[model samples]
Target: MMRVVPLQSSGVRGHDNANVDFVRESFDSEAFGIEIGRIRAAYATSAAGYRLLFKSVLQRARAEHFQQVLRRTRLENLEEVWALEATGFEMMDVVVTFARSVAPAAALPVWPDLRVEEATDETFEVIAHERAAAFFVGIMEDRPAGYVTCVLHDHTGEGEIELVGTLPEFRGRRVATRIIERALPWFAERCRVVTVRTQATNIAAANLYERVGFTLRCTEATFRANVATALRAQP
Candidate 1:
C-alpha cells in the first residue's frame, strides 16, 4: 500500500478547492518508489479532469521495468496524493461547449486543397465513442486528402478539437473549418458547452478556435519523467 499525504489548503480565490492527496507506493519492478499528486476539481460536473502533479517516484526506485505492468494494478488507483491548497493545484479551466442550433456567422473559407466529405464508417464510429470528439474527412481533386477528429466530454458539456493534422499539400486550404462546420451541430445536439483544447503554443489552432467563438479558459504547466530514471537517483 502507498501513503497519502494531506497538505494545508491555501484557499485559491477562484473555483472551489478540494483536499489534496499524495500517493507513495513500492513496486516489484526496477523502480522502487512511485510518488504522484492527484487533485480533484471541486465542481459538481459529471465530467472530471485530474491533474497529475508529480510522477518521479517510480523513477527514483528503479522500477522502470515494472511501471507498465504496475500501471494496471489496483494500487495505482487507490493510492493518490491530494493537497487542498492552491500551491498543489496544477491546472484550472472549464471547457466550453456551444449549442449547434446557433450558427456563428464566422465566414468559413473553402478548404483550398481538399473537398469536404463525411467520415467513413470506421472513423465515425470510433470518434463517436470518445470523451470529446469530432470527426471528418477532406477530399481533394477526386482523392481522399485529409481527416481530423475532435473530442467531446459528455459529463462536462465540453468539446476538444484534437488531431487536426492535414496532408502537407492540403494544409493551405480550409479543410479544418469544413470539418468543424459538420461537427458543430452534432455537439450542439448533445452538449451545452463545446470547447477546443489545443497547445497554446500553436498559433494556427489557437486562431481557429478563436475564429469559431471558442474563448480561452485557462492554462497549466505539464511535467513527465520515466520511472527508471527516478529509481537510479534514489539513495
Candidate 2:
C-alpha cells in the first residue's frame, strides 16, 4: 500500500475569504483499490460555515471510501481544530519542526570505545533502505548503536535530518545525540541551515533536540480518521 498526500493549493482566495485544500491519494496494488480525498480548511467566522465545510468533506470521504483522511491546522487555528475534531477525525499527532544554525561543534564526548562512521553500502542497505542521501552509523563494540540520515535540499541550501534511531539496548546512552552531533558538521559544510521534524508527543526526542540547540519553530495539529469508523457512526 502506498499513500500520497499532496497540497493542491496553499490556500484559495476569493473576494475577501481564503481556504486551504489538500488532496490525499492512496493506492493498494494488492487490493486493486485507489482512494482520493479532499481536505479543506476554510477561513470562516461562523459556526454554520464550519459545519457545512465538515459535512461536505465527510460526505466526500464516505463516497470515495477513503481509508484515511487527514486535516492539519496550525496550533493557533483553534476554530478549525475544534471543527475537525467535532467531525470525528481526532487529533492524532502534533508535528513540530526545529531549526538551528550550522556551526562547527565542540568534540562530542566519546562513548568509550564508540565511534561514528559514514554508513557503508552494506549498512545502508540494512539501515536506511538506500533512501538517504547520506547515512551515518554509530558503532559500539563493532555493533550498530545508532544512525542518522541527512537529506539535502540543494536549491534551498537546507539539510533535513530525516531519520534517527538508536538500538534499544543503546537508548539511554545518548547514542541518538551522538549521531546527530556527528552529522551536523557534515550538513553545515553543504547546507546553510539544518532542520528536523518530529512528533511533539515524543517528549524524549523533543528534549534531545532542545538540548542540542534546536528551538521549537512551529507545530500543527494532525487529524486522522478511518472510513469504516465514519461509516459506522452515520445513520
Candidate 3:
C-alpha cells in the first residue's frame, strides 16, 4: 500500500517497469512547507529499482517544481531502507500516528477566551453542501491563536485531525489542546475513530495528543531527497 495518502494522481505507476512507484503529494506540500513527492515499492527489489525510479522522480519533480521526495516505510524494512539510502535518500524522521474515539460530552465547552468556528462559509450559505471536513478555530485574546482541522471520511467513518498548530508565543497556553477539544464533539458525532500523527521525537506533541485521548496506533520511517540541488547540478 502507498504509505502517503493519495493526494492527487501523479507520476506513472511503473516507470521503466521498475518494482517501485511514485506520486506527487500536493496536500503534504502545504503541511510540510515544501513541495513533496512520495515513493513506494510495488514489490521488493534491489537498490537498482530505486535507482532507476529516481530518474523518473527527477523528471516529475522538474516538471512540477517539487523540492523534496519522500518515502515512508516500516522501520523493519531494512531492504527498502537500504535501497532508498543507496538512491541518495536520507532518513528524515519517524512518524507515529495515534488513534482514539473522542466521546462527546452533553455540551461542548463554552470558552471564555475562545470560539469554535466552522472551517468554511458554507455553513452560512442559503444552501449547505455536503461536507467531508470541518475546521475548528481557536480565538484567543481576540486573535486567531490556533486551529485544528478534522476530516470525516464518511466512507469509512474514520476522522483525522488532519493538521494542528499554534503560534510560537501561545505554546504553553493549551491553545492546541483547546483547539483540538473544540473539535471532539464535532468528530464524536460523525466518526468512530479520530486519529492524529506527529514526529515520534516530539514528546511534548505526543503528550498533548495523548492528553486529548489519542493513543499510538502505528509508526513509519520518513526518508527524503533534495532533488532541486540535483536538478541544479544537471545540464
Q: Quote each prediction's TM-score.
A: 0.51, 0.66, 0.68
Using TM-score as the measure, the top candidate is: 3
lDDT of 2 by residue, 1-114 (tens): 111122334333323343445455322212335464546456666544554566556666677566667776787877777766666677878899899888665654455667
Q: Where's the lowest-lDDT run of ten residues in candidate 1?
A: 69-78
lDDT of 3 at 101: 81
For each candidate, what is the lDDT? 0.42, 0.69, 0.71
Residue runs of model 3 more than 4 Å from their true location after superposition? 1-6, 10-21, 28-35, 40-42, 45-67, 103-106, 121-132, 152-157, 227-235
Cα deviation of 150, candidate 2, in Å: 2.6
RMSD value for candidate 2? 5.7
Clashes of each: 40, 0, 0
Candidate 3 overall Cα lDDT vs. reference?
0.71
Better of 2 and 3 by TM-score: 3
